[model samples]
Target: MVHYLYLHGFASSPQSAKAQDLGDRFSRLNLSLNIPDLNQGDFSHLTLTRQIQQVSTLFPPGEAVRLIGSSFGGLTSAWLGEKYPQVERLVLLAPAFGFLEHWLPQIGEVQLRQWQQENYQAVYHYGEKRSLPLHYGFISDVRQYCELQLTRPVPTLILHGIEDRVIPIQASRDYQRDRPWVQLVELDSDHSLGNVLPEIGLAIQSFFSLK
Candidate 1:
């Protein structure tokens, strides 16, 4: 059996609009789309490693998996595909590649150092609709998963927005550049990708059908 799973982005939940929308689409086709809560109700101690482990537990023995992820979750999906043979196909929406390099500058030098010293940073959790103190360990744990090590030939499809200021479209470009197993599709929307769900849904149907 092929398990279809959706992993929501950072500071988000299974109830995110995109996740729900995709879930509904899958339901209409008589398929189950399991959207796991990556935060595990503990936003303060979140890390990429934990997300990977959590999702890995869902993969049944001798079963294949098709992963669909957004942003941070997309990054996690990539790593999952790299580590697990069960993950045969991936659909990534605005994945955050070169994460720390992009985020540290946005957090700024002063705040970054302060977060390290303070051991926590007040990050707004979109899923919770409030701010939570995310541990600095999130950074250290992520550094362990280098993008260069993601050489797995898992069939992947990346849908990124040209106007995604949150995570530049160039990130996806850089990721798919040397990877022949990956396909990149550019959209006119932004990181939210709310307006292009139909297109994404259609692309997913076609991609999954071809192979």
Candidate 2:
């Protein structure tokens, strides 16, 4: 049986509308879907790693798994795919390839170092009753990890919007440049492709069918 794992964007929860839509689609297709809640008070690299490890442990061995990740989760999916060959297909939506390069310049090294030393956690409101913390370690860890690892080119589907202000669509284009197994789909919407849900769903269905 094919199992689907949906990872929400940074600061977003599994309860997000996109996650629910994917869950519903998986149910209709009779595929198992896991949407683990990554919210933890620790709000550090250790916490996020533990959450991902715990979620990964729940799946029985020898089962085919497919991953769909959005934004930071897309980066996480890339890491997971590199670490685990069992991931049959990876779908990334508006992924940020070089977050450190993009953010560190604006915040500066001194402030980032200060933030890391102080270990401050600033809560930002996401959906209702849901919040995520701004953590220096999280940003630093993701940057370090991506830089250290080689790009793992598993069968990948990249969906991005031309008007994405958060993460530029060109990032996805650049990521797909050298990767032979990547498929790029550009839409006219913004970072939030809520309006193109049906088209996204169709693309996902078609990709899985090809496999």
Candidate 3:
């Protein structure tokens, strides 16, 4: 059986709206979807490296795995797909490629400096009322995996929103350039893509034709 792993974005959890919706939809088709909490209960030390390690341990080294990632998770998928030949295919939703470069400016140099000095940064989570602590280590750690590569052409599909301010659609467009293996679908939505999830689900079904 092909394992379908769903990786959520930063500050998001396994119970994220997309993950839960997809889990139900996939289940109806008799597919098993694995949604792991990337933060592992300690958001302070979370990093791309640790996320990859967690996925590595969950999945056997040489087994076929299908990936569906969003935003930061999309970035994680890029690294995973490159390193692990077992990733048979991928579906990225508004992947956060080039995030580090854009992030510093969004936060401002002063804020970034403060975060680095304090070792933690507070950001409001989607479902939580209060802001959460995301350590500076998370930002520093992703720099290593910022560069994305696909070692071999695995069947890949990317869904990005044109109006996405968080991670610009142009990032996906630029990333897809010269990469014949990737097929990017531009949707009329925002960064979350929550409004058009049904359409996204249909696209996923058509892309993989999961049997």
Best by TM-score: 1
Q: Ranking under lDDT, best-scoring first? A: 1, 3, 2
Model 1, range 1-211, lDDT digits (tens) per residue?
A: 8899999998899989899999989999889999988998788999999999999999999899999999999999999999999899999999989888878888899998999999999999898999999999999899888799999999999999999998999999999999999999999999999999999999998888822
Q: Which stretches of candidate 1 lie over 4 Å from their true place?
A: none
TM-score of candidate 1 to 2 decimals: 0.98
Candidate scoring better on TM-score of 2 and 3: 3
Error of 1 at 209 (Å): 1.5
What C-alpha lDDT do the candidate models reach, one value each? 0.93, 0.75, 0.87
TM-score ranking, best first: 1, 3, 2
lDDT of 3 by residue, 1-211 (tens): 6788999998888888889989998999998899998978787688999998888677765679899999999988888888888898999999988988766788999999999999989887764556888889888887766464444687789999999999999999988987899999999999999899999999998888864
Please, what are the lDDT tens digits per residue for candidate 2 over residues 34-126? 887665444434333554575577556988778898887787777777777778799998876776666467667787777788775554546
> Which pairs in model 3 have colliding backbones?
none
Per-model tally of clashing residue pairs:
0, 0, 0
- Assess the local accuracy of residue 21 in candidate 3 as a C-alpha lDDT between 0 and 100: 89
